[model samples]
Target: MTNPAISICRVLLPALLLSACGANSVVISGSFPTPNIGKLPIDLAVVYDDNLLDFMYTEYSETGQEEYYIQSGQSHIQLFNAVLPAMFDNVTFVDNLEAAADSGADAIFVPNIEEFQLALPAKTRLDVYEVWIKYNMRLLTAEGAYLADWELTSYGKTPTETFLTTESAINDAAVVALRDLASTFALSFARVPEISDWLANR
Candidate 1:
């Protein structure tokens, strides 16, 4: 098949499988409550676990006697690193909380995952790995009072690729997860409609 044809197959095959599962096909779902917004205007301090990469793992697979591999969750820390500075200036995302407060933001928003899981489709006749990212956003006031909390969890599935390793699949899975998280946050926490518009464009 040509490149576009091959890509079309890759895209439609997943939809066919997911649709077959119907309600159980909820590979991604989560909620982010309205933020309190509090009484003061504040910039955001975003933080993540130092060992965020540790959440992922490698796996092996077999497809009709052919061996394959898969990769796990998205590198959210990397995404955070890339996205934060555009969200704030002069605020070290990986620094002491006190210092972040001194910089004069209304609240701190931490990016974290609660769970990630992967499962293979039994009928794909290929190895399947399921990946999930249990994520949440926490808001803290200057005095450290918990102002609001938003929980967002997402999951994705990938089978052993004809030509890719399980590790590579996992890495792809992570990207999907991060995109889901970004989409959720962009809709939920952005205070201004214009900021929300800007994120959607990106």
Candidate 2:
């Protein structure tokens, strides 16, 4: 006869181990709010530096195994596509500077990801993580002359008591941070005196 306690352990232990080994996948998305003011008059081209998209953060486990958390390239492109239309009446996404110039854009806006980091709690049971995203933006005329440069940083923290894995928590935090980033970009671009003056003069 099988001992009930032994049978229960035999069944439960494997399930617990499988749960611990499971990987989490999450999709990140954000919405851009409509601005009260009118859109900018100048047609602008948006370009992203592909080199910046190769960034990833690394984590080490207690057992000496390595883990990597990489940002989704599609997510970055989606954010720009979603937010730029709200800020400008005429916005075009261009793959290269030559394409931007050929498109007859007044100026080209280039955004680069400087840093993307994820931090997990010291203890695994905490089930929370923090994500940070930093971006550097440059505005240039169609003639390839620099107009202005700006830097933005955004961060977010995951829930402390959720049942999510560290990877899922990181994903959640990244979504929040990206949303904050888009909001900040819109506000800053609208309020910057240099940009305003350029628009007024143009």
lDDT of 1 by residue, 1-202 (tens): 4699889999999999976643221212222232223212235665554445444333333434322222222346555555555444333563556766775665666666666555554435557655667776676665567766667777655566788754556556556666666555654566544434433554
lDDT of 2 at 190: 52
Q: In terms of TM-score, how similar is model 2 to the real structure? A: 0.76
Task: Report the number of clashing residue pairs per model.
Answer: 24, 0
Instruction: Give the top-scoring candidate (lDDT).
Output: 2
Root-mean-square deviation per candidate? 14.6, 7.0
CA RMSD (A), model 1 = 14.6
Deviation of model 1 at 105, angstroms = 2.0
**Model 1 misses residue 47 by how many Å?**
2.9
CA error at residue 165 for candidate 1, angstroms? 1.7
lDDT of 2 by residue, 1-117 (tens): 999999999999999997677544444544545444557777999877775544444555667555543555567778778888877879998888989888899899998888777
- The count of backbone overlaps in candidate 2 is 0
